[model samples]
Target: MRNTFLKASFMAAMASIGAGEAGAADYRKNPFTLAYDGAITQNEPGKVNIHPVTYKLNGLDIAANVYIPANYDPKQAYPTVVVAHPNGGVKEQVAGLYAQRLAEQGYITITADAAYQGASAGQPRSTDKPAYRIEDIHGMADFISQYAGVDRKRLGLLGICGGGGYSLAAAQTDKRFKSVATISMFNSGRVRRNGYNDSQLNSVQQRLQQASEARAQEAAGAAVLYSGDANLSDEQIAKLPFELYRQGYEYYWKTHAHPNSTFKYTTSSLLDLMRFDATDQIALIGQPLLMIAGSEADSLYMTEDAFAKASGAHDKELFIIEGATHIETYWVPKYVDAAIGKLSAFYGKTL
Candidate 1:
């Protein structure tokens, strides 16, 4: 029965891909187009209003979007959630999708582009260090807690993909978040250090040396070296090894192509990413935790691993979206709805 369900879901998804081809072509001209279902094209008069915001974080201006719930009133305090975007994603993509959905559920939500990436201000852009990413989460907490209608004590957090991993790290020490949740969590540290599923274990030392050299070049004020910097043809992208990488390219490059969304990162960033582990201090997070992932996702292992190590969150729950892959959870309506449903229930109870 489960196998049959999986097959049906896969077929439906493929069918939708065929139907989306024309729409994808329409979006090809604009790189910053928000192509997801229920995207906020323009803020309605009385409906949810999306406010573009910027705040200082570690001396850099961080770009973010705050979604004000329908019929919002500043006089009444409201619960708020800070959303963290995926790697190579911006404030207007999946992160914005979830934030808008959460706002529809009556929570004021804020989604921010990571500092040094996606419309945010920083020098030597696309620097993907884990510490800076974690600090971005902390910075979001600081800014949103003081927003007009926010009740700081009623704060919750929801992170997707790479942001999920950083959110776990930030929540480990920052108790300002009363509740924590993640969707399709990507363990950036593990993947950077040992390849996806440890496939590149043999090349760890070589990669470390490469990263060290990249750092040395940066220190000497030479040109910055970037990893995963490639502009692949349609044929080349189609032939990528993993579904995560292949679908990721389709999502970021073809479907929801954003000019600021690139997979490249400063090569030296790996020096920090390789040594950091989201699960290293997982036991320190005492807030209620909800970690959601697709059951069929190759990245499910990371979510399971992190959840297993989350010993301090006695109220934790691992929810799996059946028959969905990692990237599918980012946009597929059924899978995303399942995730949002679970998230609403979790935050409704915990926040």
Candidate 2:
């Protein structure tokens, strides 16, 4: 049995974040348990339909949703896109929103919960490593390319936030994604190694030491340590320094909260995160690339940095949504429309 004290502490921590009772309620009432606005309540003939799926990736079961366009005919090939979710985000959030939107545009799309996060299976839950995240993208491609009505040769990829960064790394050599796109790209490695916007650059070594200690503790069969877990009041959330985080809290905890989504990851995973940079092999991506960011987002620098380094990407473009911030791009109606417009055009031309 797991250590009682550690298990209790973990449960307490989770409780402080948000309640999963609502999610349970959703599942019992709505078969799909979808929480987004305009989500399909039921699959009607000749209309967009969502299929909940589970597949094996490595040895883990990946929970995912596959969206097929209206009047679907499996015999005919359709361009497909593998949409990757943001860090701490689940398939029911922005990823599912985008997948559904893409499906409405007459393309097949899929979004999955990364292994070790959301509803996926893994030990030491929330153990987020770049390799695993990148592999998740590859795993999505492997499954979706072979999906009915999908054109393997015309497959594309869209990574949101942290998923954007991982998508960059995955497409560096995957070659399967003919076109790549990122919305509000976040460089997880840079942020973890340094700090948000290099704010804690001076404490890099100290954080590394802490991460080492966490790993050591885990190796010794001690309790797991997590990072980025927080419980703050509404006023406290408002006082958060960056617009990205302030709005992120609202998006994740208040407006669009979900049972499985969280902001925490294994603290020991920093050992891998500190050394992994999304732009390391970016020049190897010869496919078309489209990176989108909000004009007013403090996290826009990350997208700019990665886009600049994608030297080998053909038809590369950095499109910015006017007057929008990082989190705003996730769900705000106008911003979402802007992003979808750009994505549709890009995928239509490339795929």
Candidate 3:
């Protein structure tokens, strides 16, 4: 009986995606639809302009978007920030939203699709290795620091979700970033290793063994095995135990669906991810730091843990959006506004 109900719910979700009933707004031309009040539809004269860019990173073609502030002049130096997307996200979603908003606030911003995901080039795709992810952040800094009108000394970083964790890791050694910030930071390593909030502590060894087998399969030139790839009905999504996963499905799979965005990664990637920790060398980040999270988010503990260990930063702050959940911080207007407001002030003062 329970199986029958779940099957019905899954079918309903798939039907909704097929029928294009994910949201009222059309997605084909406006996949950037979130609750952002004044989002730009096109690059009009005297408005923020988006530049589609591609650069080579470790032999892979990395795609990115550079948002230039209105009245941009290549001759004048400008402070720039690199926005990194969440684990399974592409550059056109939340990352781009924050980049656009920052540009509107008079700062140059760039958001890039990670090398192995989105429109970027990579093989055996969706490999979520930590080294590659951290390298992606470094690659962004390498390209954006040299961009026309950018003041290399005033470079900053804003990472969301899994990207936030990588930003913390990247900024630890990349002193080029004058300031670093994260929103709804997810300690990918901790979560992947022990499950969300350490709920899977007992399964750590078992998962490691599974990851090892996946790696062996890849070594034998067999088909790649992945994890976390699922197609669910709206009803199934609604019934998800965690608010983060539930709303995540709605945001990524429905309202903001993009051809490249996915929630899957090569199972072998966990071998490296399980060993990483965003707070490992956090104290080495001497630059000013800001961590933001929804007060009600299940992921709040990750931010708090990292914040508490970021003792090297002479100036650090942990700000919470009063009523937001994890996904709400991604698109909800009020929460986004509060985050951007704090970001503007923080960057304005530091950069």
Q: 44, model 3: CA deviation in Å?
A: 1.8
Residue pairs with backbone atoms closer than 3 Å in model 2 (clashes): none
| lDDT by residue (tens digit), candidate 1, 1-351 | 323433553354344445546344223232334556677767777798788888999899888989999999998888999999999888878998899899999999998889888778786778999999999999999999889999898999998999999999999999999999999999999999999987899999999999999999999999999998677787998897788998898887767665567788999999999999999989999999999999889999999999999999999999999999999998899998999999999989998
Off by over 4 Å in 2: 1-30
Candidate 2, residues 1-351, lDDT tens digits: the string is: 224433554465356545654432132245676656677889999999999999999989889999999999999999999999999989988898899999999999999999888777787888999999999999999999889999999999999999999999999999999999999999999999989988999999999999999999999999999999887899999898888899888787766766677899999999999999999989999999999999999999999999889999868999999999998898888999999999999999999
Clashes of each: 0, 0, 2
What's the ranking of the predictions by TM-score, best on top? 2, 3, 1
State model 3's lDDT: 0.87
Error of 3 at 306 (Å): 0.2
Report the lDDT tens digits of candidate 3 across residue range 133-240: 999999999999889999998999999999999999999999999999999999999999989878899999999999999999999999899998898877898898
Pairs in clash, predicted candidate 3: 13-233, 13-234
Q: Tell me the TM-score of each prediction against the true structure.
A: 0.91, 0.93, 0.93
Would you list the C-alpha lDDT of every candidate in the order shown?
0.87, 0.90, 0.87
- Better candidate by lDDT, 2 or 3: 2
